[model samples]
Target: MSQHAEQAAAFVLHSRPYRETSLLVDLFTLEHGRISVVARGARRSGSARRFTLQPFQALHVSWAGRHELKNLSQAEVPQVMAPLVGKALLCGLYANELLQRLLQPADPHPRLYLYYTYLIQELQQSADLEGALRTFERQLLENLGYGIGFSHCHPGCYYQYDTQQGMIEVTADRGCYTGTDLLAIAEDRYETVDVRRAAKRLMREALAPLLGVKPLKSRELFIKTRRTA
Candidate 1:
């Protein structure tokens, strides 16, 4: 109705109550990447926001503002996904946290959005959570410009990734890990237990270059679950 109103396709990545009756919503929009908007009076008992804040549900939202926190004028689910079960839900939350932390505001990444949508479907149907997570992690890193190199040699040399300098070439004096090993990871050939473990390690090593030494809390929780089981 208002000239200032604009609609965008989005998903509720996260939401929290503001001062009293307002809510701050973290949204991932198809055209705007990640955005934080204020839904005034949406926290009231019978407010529309109460019904529209569910995560991972497709949404069409109308918001207007000039500041970082825009005003929400409309919100609703456009298409609901098949419900995520058990650890899949937690995995989704972990993915949301990663996006929130790694992505810069207002940067659109439609490819990554598609990848995330496919990942949700995969998680819903996956029998191998570790495999799915490892694959997703690799994809996320690659999309973020931290892609691992598993191909080619520098001139007359051949070498494997050092996990520090990316890739080095083979020489007469020093032996290096081969592109074969790195490619195996890129291709998700986790057939053997050893290879599967190696895939996990490679991903972790690759993530280290970008994410640094600090561990993700969600990943730590997932690890503890495995240790106790």
Candidate 2:
């Protein structure tokens, strides 16, 4: 019995050479979380499949096979992001790494796909790198089911974010709270350094519980490695 295949709108999250003439592609689809597809003979110079599978571009793709590694039939970029230079390029790669690491194959996350597209656009156009990344990280966390709690609290009852327990209302002496921190986040008031730092800390803490002890190497490299001209 031959199994049928379907086309999907996707983006190339990452790709690497497979054997001699093939390529292993990690893709994010509008319907699938992260999928691994093999582009046979894509490594040959001047192959249209090779040129079409670059990251940060929207692609229409078709693949077949019931196994984990599907055989890719076609890929074409429908929308192209403007060229990202310098740190922006590295940042884009970091985003792809995060998706590759955190998302499981075959699970669908349509909303996350939209958020990812928006993040790429923002990174391509923005001058404030930190703000753009911070925003995307927040969205990523929420989509992964580890959303942060930044709601307002009573004068004495504070909401402390525990990496293990999530957001909890605790006594002021035992926990931490800034009045309406969650409300501010909900309202999109992420302008100040304090707000951004708070969001980053919350997301990192939440991610710790899920991502285990493995640190994101791309983020570390971004901080430690110097960019070349």
Candidate 3:
């Protein structure tokens, strides 16, 4: 039994070298979830796919296979995609890494795919890049069924996520999320530094267990670049 997809919406999650000149590409697709495919001779000088196949690029792809890894027959840019640079570029990579690490292969997550596309678009022009990422992270967690609570609390109160007890309201703010900040973060109102920091920490806490012991390379890279810059 063979399977085939034609001109399906997709984004390249990661691409790495294979035997000789080929590329083993991981793709997140609207119709088919995460998949791995070999882009034959993509390293050749004239292979335009070498340019088209990359992170944050919107693509329409055609693939066929019977086994897990598919044969990518065609990949084309669906439209003009504005390139993401600097912080936005890094954010795009982080999103890709999250999807690669957390999402299972061959499982369709249409809503998550849509959220991912919107996140890429938002990162392009968002004044608050971290806000955009936090929004995406929240959506990612919800889509994966690890929904974190950020509602129904006092304005000045603080809270934290507890696996055994859900959202636990706490007194001290040192390691807890303030109700005001939580509301703002939940609504994407990243106006204050306090709110932004709280959102970042909350996301880290929620993602830590799912991500396991291994640290995200994206976080390390972001920290290193900020220090040097």
Tell me the tens digit of each residue's lDDT in model 3 across 1-229.
5565544799999998889999899999998899999899998889998988877888899888877888899998878688888999889889999999999988888998998888888888755678778988998988889978666766878788786565788887668777888888778788898988888888888888899999889889999999999
Work out candidate 1's RMSD over C-alphas: 3.9
lDDT (10s digit) by residue, model 1, range 1-229: 5448767888788888898998888988878888888889988988867767867667889889777778888887766667676788778877877788777888887877877776777777856666677777777777788877665633344454576677666653443444555566668765667556767666666776666676777788878877887
Residue 180 miss distance in model 2 (angstroms): 3.9
Ranking of all predicted structures according to TM-score, beginning with the best and ending with the worst:
3, 2, 1
Q: Residues 108-210, candidate 2, lDDT per residue (tens digit)?
A: 8898888788778877886667667766777888888877755544434457777766677876653365545555555556778766766666666667777
Q: In model 2, where do residues sit more than 4 Å from their true spots?
A: 152-158, 170-177, 226-229
CA lDDT of each candidate? 0.74, 0.78, 0.85
Better of 2 and 3 by lDDT: 3
RMSD of each: 3.9, 2.7, 1.8
Models 1 onward score TM values of 0.79, 0.87, 0.92
Among residues 3 or more apart in sequence or in different chains, the pairs in candidate 3 whose N, CA or C atoms overlap within 3 Å are none
Error of 1 at 224 (Å): 4.5
Instruction: Give the poorly placed runs of model 1, Cα more than 4 Å off.
Output: 1-3, 153-164, 169-178, 188-192, 224-229
